[model samples]
Target chain A: MRQLSEQEFALIHARLKSLNIRYIEVYEEIFDHYCTTLENVPALDSQTTIAKLNETFACSVVKNMDKELEKSVSKQVWIAQLEFLKFWKHGVKGILIGLVGFFALAISILLIPASELILVFLVLIFCTTGGIYFMKRDAMNFSFQHKSVSVSSIAVIKRVGLLNSLMCWIWIMPIVLSGGNILSNNFFAIGMAVATILSIIYSISLIAVASRLPKSTLL
Target chain B: MSNNNLIKGSLQTIILKLLEENEKMYGYEITQRVKELTAGEIKITEGALYPALHKLEAEGLLSTEIQQVDNRVRKYYSLTKDGQKQVTSKMSELQGFVENLQRILTPDLKPGFNI
Candidate 1:
């Protein structure tokens, strides 16, 4: 078996970038497949493997189908994310953890001064977003793959930001509009507390789900 | 024997059964194994294979891991506990389908009746 030189590998990488592959996840897998097939299948032994990879991934009308592959992969990612929402559906451990989590959150909310609670929420959200960014940064190497958003992580951050917007609209808008301390008001304070607790739980679940995504996470 | 639709319909079962035995396999390895086992009668197409894999993964029957092999990273798929259970049911379902197809194709063959 002839080992391809670094130049040949670089050529293959460049060709893959031109294949209209949309997702980083798909691109990475195909890159490996292409390289492996080319490396393993000797021209004298089996040129068919190389032909197959080239025909489908690099050099033919397989472009349409490759797009479909990317779409299917994208769909798979979305489905996996949705499934993470049901973390407690199948097991007692998850429910127990959730129970423990909510209890801890309730205690924290109750003990912390209501006036300072808004700062707590801000800090929690900030930490969650920043943590996810760092995790994604390690997984993605932008110099290798030509892509946007690294791993759809930016889109997820946008979704997280959207949640923050909704929370601000619900909890902070009234205070700003009416020029009053909505935090001191019992109705809004209790409402915000419940909302904040639920948000924390949601963020925890989101982070938990995001954490599980390895290099396969794509946009 | 080279029926694309038949193989397509059974691809998930084939994949799950393979993972059940091997415990873990990558996409290209799965194709090579199928070819080796069938003596080249069944060649899974590149177009069909990845999408099917993605679909099965989306269904939560398979999970993937990435390891750096040489210069590139390979994504290996292994059956989840749910996937292991599915292998049994999918294999049984495929057997039932083949049996019914046999009955239709050979309706004249009857037991204990010599004509």
Candidate 2:
């Protein structure tokens, strides 16, 4: 197979970039596939090959496939977070860390007045979201350059930060609607307590997960 | 791929079996191999190929590595240990299914039912 010229590769890259793929890992694979397929076509000019390829591999088709890649990558990160939360087998160190997190979170929940619970949840969300941003700072840098994010970066933000924030709302929603009387509901309270402990552990695991990501994601 | 529905269920098996033979392949290479092996009778669309590859990777049956190749990065996939084991079971499963279908398609291949 002939090597695609820089101009040819750029044309394909710009087109793939236009598709606005979420993950860099997905983008690179698709870019190679498009280039390889185009190169195999008999004797068409690069521009014509590109046009033919673009027409065939429509943006929607690639986008939908990227969505699947997004889902699959997210699933592993989510599972890994839970796996890291396994206090016994995964590590005794994580057990100590999880316990520390749980104790701190439980105390905060116990001491924070009912009226301020919503504010606390909001702060918690902001912190988790902000933490991912600061922790995965390289993803931000890479995204600006290439218009795509590494799998682990997006996974940490979407699966851990965003979903965990939504999980927080479950605890605060009823409290706000029922004029704080829901605070006395033992069942709801216990459920929230369990969720709180899990979230705390999961959040700690997020640190472990984020740090585990490849530091030098390809440019 | 004319028989997309027929190919759909067997895509994973095909991928696993190919990797078992070749040891490693990138996405496009896998597609071309399938085309060559079947003489263009079977085609794996990129749309179907990628998600299937990603799903297999997610399931621990495949693993990927990224390398700079031909002026661009290419991601290569190969069987994990679990993936190697899966190939044996999946190959047997696909073969069993194919054999049964063969019996159904060509009744002379098997003893006739006398209900």
Candidate 3:
């Protein structure tokens, strides 16, 4: 067996470090074993030792696959998803601003003559757009290249969120129905109550989920 | 050894023996050598191997060096002066264990077995 050259040795050393295997004993043991094996093969010498060592290290049983480790990693991903929802909920400042806009519309609903409900309608449109924008942007960094959320995590959250949101909507249906038709006097009152209750519940749950996650530094 | 065989307590002995012959080595190589020598009889995963290596290094018996390769890096390991002495001490301890086992097993060679 050919002995490992200085360069080859350096390369091997570098590779091992990358794997986070940083012990002097491990290095020496491997070298000794490689040399000992090489010595047994009369046709090979020190020059071939590295080649043998490389092959052996590449195929070593030390790099065994571990299912437990994989499971832990996936669990972490799940937690991160939960945290993202929390993060989104924590964007309460934005939500509050949107509510301010809604409040302004409320004043208009009461003070302005019923002939100009168009102003209230326009205000509602703008508030919804602004709330959605801030929720998307401030909740998580969603740039295409630097996207942090995992697809699995997003899928899981969306599934849960959809179910939860649907429940909230169901609870708010009475308010929506009580709003009555656009031509009715109870429209604004019922619309405001339904919107307020749903927003509060959604905000509280999202923030609570984000805050309750176990603190981990793996990321 | 069989899969059911337990080599937990003997890992240090095995490590010492390997280092006694070679001047230095690294984590990946040591694991590889054990597998090759044992012909797959024993396998050490990265998870188990790293902690052991870190513990042994912490005990002041091992030192490390970082070297850069073409596209990656690796760490090489070597024994300190104290580590060398440790090898001999560990070897004798292992020898004692084997001798005791032999004495217990080969009772026919004892003074009363033939009688």
Candidate topping lDDT: 2
RMSD in angstroms between candidate 2 and the native structure over all alpha carbons: 4.3
Compared with the true structure, all predictions reach lDDT values of 0.70, 0.77, 0.51
- Docking quality tier of candidate 1? acceptable
Evaluated at residue A118, the lDDT of candidate 2 is 48
lDDT of 2 at B71: 66
- Model 1 segments beyond 4 Å from truth? A20-24, A43-52, A58-120, A138-145, A148-162, A168-185, A211-219, B1-3, B58-60, B63-65, B109-115
TM-score versus the correct structure, for each prediction? 0.69, 0.81, 0.34
True contacts kept of each: 0.45, 0.70, 0.00
Model 2 agreement with the true structure over A130-203: per-residue lDDT tens digits: 68778877566443454677877767766565666577578657777998788766666556666655565566
Flag regions of model 3 displaced more than 4 Å.
A1-219, B109-115
Ranking by DockQ: 2, 1, 3
What is the C-alpha lDDT profile of model 3 across A139-206, one tens digit per residue? 24445433223222233344345644664454346446766244344554555445544444344443
lDDT of 3 by residue, B50-76 (tens): 445555655667766655533334556
lDDT of candidate 2 over B1-115, digit per residue (tens): 5978899999999999999999789988998999999999998887888999999998989988878876678889999999999999998888888888878888888554322
User: What value does the TM-score of chain B take for model 3?
Assistant: 0.78
* Sliding window of 10 residues with minimal summed lDDT for model 1 chain A: A148-157
What is the lDDT for A23 in model 2?
73
